[model samples]
Target: MINFYSFRDLTRHTLLLSFIFLLFLGEANAGVVVGSLTENFTCDGQIYQTFPTNGDTKLFEAKLDESGLVFTPRLSPNNESIEVQIKALLPGANSVSLTNSLAFNPIDNFLYTVVRANLNDGKGKRLIIFRIDRNNVVELAGIPENNGTIIDEAGANVSSSGLVAGAFSPINNLYYLTGVRKPVYVVDITDMSFKKFSAHNFNIADIAIDPVSLSLYASNKRNSSNQLVQIEFDDINNPTTIVRKGNAAPISSQVNDAVGASYFTPAGTYIGYQNKPGKIFSINLTTGRTTVLANGPNLVFNDGASCPFDFEVDLDNSTLTIVADDAIADGVDINTIQATLLDVNGNGSERKEVSFSATNGAIIGSCTTNFFGKCLVNVTNVKAGISVIGATVSDGTLTDTVSVTFIPGAGDPLKSLITANPTTLVADGSSTSTITVQVKDSNGNNVNNGGDTVNLTASSGTIAAVTDNNDGTYTAIYTSATTVGTATITGTLNSIVITDDASIILKNGAPDAGQSVISANPTTLVADGTSISTITVQVKDVNGK
Candidate 1:
């Protein structure tokens, strides 16, 4: 029994044990791996690891067995007294760079941290820049702090072109270092030239640029408190204390050890944080209302030992990555973990299904929600003639791929019909004539009250009064005064014109008494052709002759 094991079996067993030991040690040493992504293998669920420490030069690398993809992160060695805070990490042509006030580039294989001596003279305030290439080589791209004459030098920090999040001005292809402190600096990367825009008084923690609006949002953290202040970087660099004092959570409770970790979401709808417990909070930029989204075990803070220093969000994946310190004392380990994919597509069974008509300007239906979230946006305002109708469903995480189509049919064209009542009438002097016009569309539907206006104009007669009854009918009164002619009335409704003609005759003084004709000669003619005296003489002659 003592000599039972074969050499081959023993060798295999040893190799397996060694691999397991390496895996366990790697997990233990890697610290607080919060990042924009996590790789998932189809076979095993082992997460790739990459994290940066305050004063560590050896960049960590973790290789998973499933896909043969090597995940390596470059780190800058800890300069304890120097206190090089990693504000931003940008990838370059062949290398990666770390930046604080000064830029630090990692040597090949993350061997040693080096500063560009030519770029930084160690004299006036300077900004250092290093870029990482695809091969993971670090390159020092000189980003001078202030090469031009110093207009003001009070509370200014040098920024490089790589601050990727916020709005940038194309007028100056540079990075803006803005704060509530004195003499804010704008350094252009092209010429390595800088100009003092204005004075900033507070410590500028983070800067964000709104590309669409071309606005800058700078978040400031005061000395001792967790009170976050926001300043708008307009033309004048005006400071408006957005997060007022005593309104924010206590400094100890909110930011932990990492100050100024707060930033707005890309949409500027929410403000979130990394490296602090329950740091992600939704903020209404207008009202300054803050609400915590998801906060629990996953968001534990490192008390400076392994502080969650920086964070970024991959909106496409709906995942957030938080970078933290990998110090030994805090027991914080860095390992990329799979994101919990949440199927936000709500229950489709209970939804009200609708079908839209092929008619133009038809409203299919409307959607409303009690929760604030993005909806599926597939319906177009333009007409596609008779085409398939498809609905878009989004849960802020995933969108629907299925689309619905609507069949096309011949439809009536929209029209406004104007009909006038009393098509024909006889108009006379001192006679009241009323005209009523109704407006409807070609489909025999009454037009909306707010849609059209009706106007009645009379050419030959005077319109005494015009009244709009709001039921698409307009009453117009016409007064005829001695004008014996046809009174033509034109009704215009919604640009459609129609005319009605009415004939009027002025009789001789409104029919004489007893139908007798009295001329200017004071003689009244009877039914007979002779006058009254000739009638009396004829009656006497008829009796004699």
Candidate 2:
């Protein structure tokens, strides 16, 4: 009774297990700094954000935060890193490379993500959709066709897979993505594997969708000029009209270089985009006016896409009003609060003044916060049409500015950003330094009443106290710590983050015992079996730092 057939079954089972682990590898998401993401999304109850890490590599990952200040790329229940999970499921390819990606889910059982990468099969920039099932198993769902060539703007062949932006639609079961020097692609998610997505010859830098209409949009550049083009994709099979061709440029041609990326909020209240100088601009789909959110210089997301999260979708919900992204660590939530100052008056006047201030920014105004993150500003006596409204918020260490337009029929004027008096301070405990923060509008108008409260904190020292002068300025009189490094001073306007750094040097009180090490410059021997060396001596105060 040696059951010989049972042995065959056991061998087959072993092969299956080995095949499942063919790409057996995983890496822990170690120490990394996650910034104030413009937006983020959640899928299967897991949070994800995208940042241009490692020199502008647009990456999206399921990261988690235990501290509100930073986030660590998290490990899944299946013990897989993002790259390993993606590489294992690549279709018919030995090697895979992926850059930017966004998630799409039209069905409950499938998590579809469109990734930009070369699967080493010589197919240009492929928007490969990888589907993850309930068991955390992955498989390639399909590859959307790249409607353009692998050529750069210079007209020669290039190696880069210039896929830039992506958005998924539950309306047509499609994804709207863009590539450089190529057209906007409308890929059908429900299509068979290796099928082509319908392409609209709209060469644009980024693409976003109207969550309600599922319509596509792009700020396309032609002849060094940029125009915001709209695409209607009801058919999803083919397009009769070229969306970007012959369209009038939205702004001056000088704005061509300022075009960056785009994303629609879960509510689709507005479509947010970034300019070349790292500012986030929002175009109200209804009003078509631009609202700017000014950020740091390196805004790569700094170098990556600004819209990093595309969270879970409730296909069952008709409005597609699904989950939004939030970063919560312990009891603190460092979330991007997107508030829309709609026709706040309800009287529908075409002109109003809007002023913005955050509690953390210590800038208080006539405007106040409401339930929906909206600001109710007294628009009395304010001239209408695109008035500059400034919004700023900060934590102790990070500062952010949100640029908004008060469409004359809406709110009041803006407030100013806190300008540090000295911008730098020396940390030497007894020597006191005075730091002032002011609130101004976009027009450089001071709105501080001096009574505003400013809270100050330092990474390397203690901020004794902040005093309100009752003008628009708040001052913090601080004594530095005994350290010899830069101490960062952060002022929080409730949520607006304004910060400055001061380098601390050892105040030449007296010299103390120190040690020095000597080393050779070229440690490796040269061809003549000899090497050059250099030695330098240094001294330090009693404090090792």
Candidate 3:
């Protein structure tokens, strides 16, 4: 009893079935369906495959095969890994490094591969560079720095020197390149004029840079084992300290050294690394959990373990593209939720709190938006039933919300978010800021959690009181005595974290809002009827503006 249907038809049928099942379960009374969401794609019109187990679920990648189009699987390691397909092979070029010397610039949105000229000059080895994209590939020229002395043994090419590791820094927006023994090179993407970083003596094996946190992670092998370390640019523009994180993986009595490294920008906190044998392993820094997401063929780095792995992470869409069909966006246990805040003009809204809570599951994550009026949150403890989500947003004065529900059937159910409004409030003296929260689900439906517990806290301000709206909504009243300071309010729904940052302005009193119009002495001055009467009026302000 097999009925064949097209991929598009299958998707519609699946959604239809899920909708029917949800109706029988009965909607929660606490949740009110205020509005519906129509925008499903990201700001760039991209879609994320959020752990949908069913066939024909929206996928982030497609393979161009003879069959026309095929969706790629994420969790299965038997298939190809994501990074292998994205690495642009530069052997087609004239002179490029045959080694793993590639980096992806999140700002420039370009993939660059480094190669050294074959000349045997001790210092003036011209740097051969290539900037690659999907349709166009251009070669760029760069000159290498002498760095006091060039280590010929660190050569990546037949020439005296080579590029072994490279990464992009979100802090200074600079591209960092390094060899076995040469000092770290910081090259400005625009000017390409590069300089060595602090003239360090350590020979970095490979490097991974977190785009959002701006932390530099590098590894060097000690006695056949690898030691993972984090480099902090206390000044950002300058490197000051290095903190060792011990072994990246378990250092058994048996030797195991991690070689290649790449940063996953969408998660903003995890790294894809490989030790001996080149199997791709993703390590979650937030949870301290590591899992093998992809199996590798015979690939080797310096100690016959390192391999070149590169892929593009679109933070807005939360998709890993340009990788092979074997990319694993599914191994992510962190729930990356997204919410769009808008104003009356239908533009991106500001200073909003976006939070989610499931009626029968655990919620996780907290985030705020930039000027773009959007945010990505990671949620956990997802169940296969209906989930409620809430949000609150303010324009530095007042706040509002949108609550909805989602039926996450074997997939993630949390969507949307917002933040505390009126982030800036007047200091004390009978002044209070009201914090409001709204809940919603992934499909834009609203669900009630029977006055579910919503966690709230503030860093500098006092949360004097809180009131539950009884309908998946709550308000926290806070007053600050500090003259000039900022308070950060953090809320948790189940496990999902929602945050709001507010500023308190200290003043003698509120300045004059406007002129107070004084009434005339004669209530009804009848000038035309019988007698003409003089009228007196005055205008005044609290500050006499």
Candidate 4:
């Protein structure tokens, strides 16, 4: 016999189903979790994307979450059969903004191209520019494939100004555009005009401008070795490499097919780089020393095909997100890894080494081994500006150098002007005074016996005695005659005019008794004493005159 379900029971079941549906909707609408994917590549015609099924099919997605806020990575299409690599995620307008390259333009919608993927700028369109629409979509704006000339027929990478360091100069309100080959051009975006000066043949990789010093720093990668050459430019148009051979450390290994990326720390004290094996290293710009702070696990799968292509530092979070690729035959093989937070003790030394797995995107292993022990050399009691800080890590099997720059304090050295105790006194009347002065350096340290001198001169008064305490202090005594008048005194140092115009007052002589003086023909009674006499003398200031 068949039985029918009760109406109440059916109603209860329906309510339960509705409640479950609402719960699922809430979860879907909820913001991204800590490790949840916020963005991913779907199906874009980019060579940099991996196919998972075929090594040649560059078609993968870039996955991101809210945790990866500052970084915006993208995949570009390449005509070559080989797999393409995404090197960096530069600043963009919004989430959908993707470009072949990244550069800062003075104008709102300037263009740029991604040159060597993870290597150096190779050839045609090695330097390209793009424009972003209001919708945040990137389009090819300028693609100057020409190897020479500042402006081509197509108005590609041509700039109003001549050759410069990078495509952008935020400090000087300028922008540069180059043709990958020769002649770098610079333009003054403030005035919307091109500069007459142009930089000659020079391989510029990354550039940084010092706003305070008005100096430009250009990183040049050598054609033969992975070494980086540093060039300083007074103006972006005319570049000069301060070190011909470049800094002491090499940016990358000598192995073939290796690439590196570098950036200056926000503080500008250190420059950091990311290489294969998902490692991060920094060079002290002042000392020219390099130190490896974090080294991720070596890519052993896919015959070392698993490598880190590009990386960016989120100084706010103190975390580094590396775009890693496990170049297996399928698109699903492409992935990214968040490097373990390095425990640096301000000394540029690591407290421990931690490695995470890119496959699971989790912490895999860690060790307390000090890799820099052999490479670090101790440099003690060194002065600022190119002082070598050496460290020996791993028992000195390898060596490394660190450059340290020390900045001096600001303000004048002397705190107060020299002052005298009794600035005004009677001359030749036996008056004692103290001339005191305080000498110090910018650091507030007393500059004892720094060859300081003080000369006392009398404009009207006489100096009976003068003595130097030798501790930035002095004393002087004066004697005045019985003449009723005022005297002026002054002080000097090495003709620098330390102090001037001090005054002293002189009074009349004392009275005596039983003394008589003869006067002129009228026989006037002139007495030195006996007759009570009261005198009122007005004090006069000599220097006031």
Candidate 5:
């Protein structure tokens, strides 16, 4: 069935279908949809072709009698492969050549292309930039047209060549262009002005950026083979210089000649396209390792761009893990704690900040994770007790906790004893005696755990105050009362649950004979010896008791 539809309808239909497919494919299966310029109108002498077997499930295609632009979607190379090509069209245009550069502006939802155009006055060809919308609509892009003053490149002159590569950086909303061994030309889309800066050192072929980190990646043959390098800007907003960061390992030979590169943000994957064999591969941002995914139409003037896929944090599926020793010795022990964060797929998320806390010790409050999604902090000045260490993300979305027990170097409090220096006190109510309590461990050695709570109590006398000697002993003043009795002094070690007691005697003071008074029951005793009357007498001391 052949149903002819307008280019707009076809574009909308294709976009809807692709969106639906992507919805079904979760983050793990998500891929980068790329549109680049092919070397020739016809790829490898085939007008239309498809890879049924040993092909990436995501399609790659080229067309005949059309512009050099071709669209390819790179899928999980290790899992599935497919290749296909279909007819392409443009409004009121049949054939065109995009030999210079292609970039997609995510903010404006327009594809920008720099192409050579000729004037009707026979003034030689001049480079003109054009923008295309999703509905296959194209228009001259650079606004407030410059009279060759803003753009000073030799190629800007209608007589010479111009840009060899281009990339659109969403970080600063600027378009970048460069030529062979030439300084980069910064194009401000807002003002349509070009500023030149010699920041890049390599002969850049194509550049891609990670919007999250603003890391600019370039594919260049600076060291004899095409390799991936990261370009760091002094300031993305107002950049004056740039430095190149090389990969830790060499790029695979399979992607040695890769000319086009793009980053798939959903999976944190970098993709590269090679024209020599029309193959696609993935590049490791740190190691520069490449894994070929599929083969398709050969493209020479190739460059790709895809929307930075936003990955939602799975709060329920993501996990936070903490690692530390369960038990720490009393002395000379390392107290380092570590935390790791992983997404739903169990892959580490880099550059995340996490906070740490402890219950009974001092610890580093926060730490930022590295490339491995891991961070470390130290716990110091811990006490002799169990402490819980907790780690949580900045947003408090994920959390993990662990417990550690610190052994006391001095020893644990076991038993307690109470004693009085002067075990006896006068009953005058003004006499006081010294009371002391000592604590010992299981080995009968005086020990201070720095957290011992010793309480003192007296059955008769009053304890004026108690003082912790800070060693293993405590002291208190026992005030005596007028009544003669024995004060049972009790000492309790609250932390270790041990108790002991000692007795203090309150004895009567010396009787004063001068103050003593005597009384007789019968004042007048019968004087007669024969009348022996009963006589009774009472005596009083100084206290009148």
Candidate 6:
């Protein structure tokens, strides 16, 4: 017997059959998937690490060309190329809007989305959760317990209807949904059974969970800035008390609208999208700073979802090295201590903050890696010992270390010895002697680097400028004084408690003809040779010798 159905039923059956056919043609692909209100979703094809570039716009534009979907006001670009493509035509054909949110469950290998029915009777306002199959085709997942057919444990309707954000935790195998100041709803996708989670004070706009830690976080607008807050629970799997933990830092102005957020575990960053400026950005879980990744197609009532395998940081392949510009030495300043991070797909990563520490030296506490994934710090005041220099990324995930042995350049002033070539010298002003000053370290090693200074002074002679021989010895010329006396030669090294002295005796030299005078008492009597006058002569030097 042939049965005739109404027009509404015929249309519903046609769409259902069409959707099934689309699912049959499903092809496998992988990426971070984003959904919009128009039931259009696209998998982000850009590399996760290269998030700061706007090159992904071309991928979206290409998708639009294939789908032949009209670009509406919300999807239009503002000085940017088309950013996303409509993967399915279910929104207009099936009379539904994906306004609520979207989430991906890696365990089931399905992408789930929440959609609102666009019926004029307002009878189908209840939110419906649908799963996007591998071929980008939409299928009904389940109806949430929101005063509808679905019921809670008490067989009562959960009068809650609005859910703006959603996230799936592979650890617990539950999908979490919530709205601003609403109690979280946890659903077991295996059976579609759900429960209302503990209430929280945070007005969350979107939510993401760290896959490694199983810690849930929310993007919130607080005090004029978009910030990230930790939504803590007594037990995430079976929670009784939920509390808000963080308001520490604000995500920068780049993230204006927190439409959706997802955690890319490979790089340990929370990826989010803004609807206003159509900006894709990543938030550092450690610092609340936000970095604009790319400008893509704007989405209204949008949501983002990503699998853990979307991007990868092959730590085994990645490498880090500590490079020193020169040989390290004690008390020497090493201005070129660099830590280079490399090997993410065989290339340097973007600028990231790195921390430095040393075992037996002082170093700059932290530095940010440059475009080449290299960071520099200065090491100073190193002791004469083996030192280990450690460099770590801000998250403490990637680390590298190098050991350096510092040689003692010049130590404390230990000993200074002064010697005179001739300990005794004539009092003639022209006579000179050598004064040598030898400097040594605590271990009696010659301070060959000239790190120590030497000075010479004579008590009774004129000393010339000291000369550094660079072999731990210094020399100066000392001239003997005309006045016969002892000359004390003093030498100091570094002027820090190291001093030596030597004395030189200046004896009388042969009388200098230029400085001597001779007087003859019988000068007048010499003329009278016959007078037999007694003759006497007096000879003296300038000093009356």
Computed on alpha carbons, the lDDT of every model, listed in order, comes to: 0.33, 0.41, 0.41, 0.33, 0.52, 0.55
Backbone collision count in every prediction?
44, 48, 41, 58, 7, 1
Greater lDDT among 4 and 6 belongs to 6
For every model shown, what is its TM-score relative to the native structure?
0.34, 0.40, 0.38, 0.30, 0.40, 0.49
- On lDDT, the candidate that comes out on top is 6
- Which one is best on TM-score? 6
Q: Tens digits of per-residue lDDT for model 2 on 433-484?
A: 6666665434343543444445667666666667777766677765667755
Candidate 3 vs candidate 6: the lDDT winner is 6
Q: Looking at model 3, which ten-residue stretch has the lowest summed lDDT?
A: 28-37
Query: Which stretches of model 2 miss by more than 4 angstroms?
Result: 1-51, 55-81, 88-95, 99-103, 106-112, 115-127, 131-139, 144-163, 181-185, 193-201, 221-226, 234-260, 266-270, 273-276, 294-372, 377-545
> Tens digit of lDDT per residue, candidate 3, span 119-173?
3323333454444332222223222333112333334332335456677665354
Across 1-545, the per-residue lDDT of candidate 6 in tens digits comes to 11112223334335444433333333212111112223333333222111112433211111111123232222223232112222232343344434444666666656666655532233334445666544343444544433122333444333334466787775565888776666677766554556676556666656776665566777786545577767766667666666556663577877656545444433456666666667666677776567775676565445556554432323444344546543435455463466665534343443566666778655546777543346677665444455677666644545446665554455444555788998898887868999987765544434555545777888988999988787667889999998888999876666664555889999876565666665655556546447554444344454544
Q: After superposition, how far is residue 487 of candidate 1 from its true place, in Å?
A: 70
lDDT of 1: 0.33
How many Å off is the CA of 181 in candidate 4? 6.7
Q: Write the per-residue lDDT of candidate 5 for residues 1-545, one digit (tens) a residue.
A: 11112223344335434422332333222222222221112111111112222322122333211123345433322223211111122222222224234555555655555544333223333344555443333334432123212234333452135464666676555776664455666665654555676535565566666665565666666554766666666665565667545442356776656465344343345655665667666665645557665665665545555544343333454444435553344334446677666544444444567777778754445776543456777665335556677766645655456676654344333445678978998877778888877766543445554456766778886887778788777788988878898888876676554456788888877766765566555556677776544454334346764
Candidate 1 local lDDT, 1-545, one digit each (tens)? 01111233333234333322322343322111111111211211111122234444323333322223243553333322111222222211112233222211111111111122222222332234333222233333323333212334533223322222222242334445443354445544443444555454555444444332335444445544344444444442332222222232222334432322233322343243433442344445555555554442222211100001112221243321212211111112121111222112211111122222213332333332111222221232223122222232233322211222222211112333333343443344555567665554444444324334566677665665557676555667766544445566666654556433333342223333444432344346676766553222221111121
Ten-residue region with minimum lDDT total, candidate 2: 26-35
- The lowest-lDDT stretch of 10 consecutive residues in candidate 4 is 301-310
Which residue pairs in model 6 clash with each other? Answer: 83-297
Error of 5 at 460 (Å): 27
RMSD of 6: 13.2
Candidate 4 ranges beyond 4 A from true positions:
1-101, 105-128, 132-136, 139-165, 178-181, 188-204, 210-214, 223-225, 236-260, 269-280, 293-545
Which of candidates 1 and 2 is the stronger one according to TM-score? 2
Instruction: Write down the RMSD of candidate 5 (Cα, Å).
Output: 15.3
Comparing 4 with 6 on TM-score, the higher-scoring candidate is 6
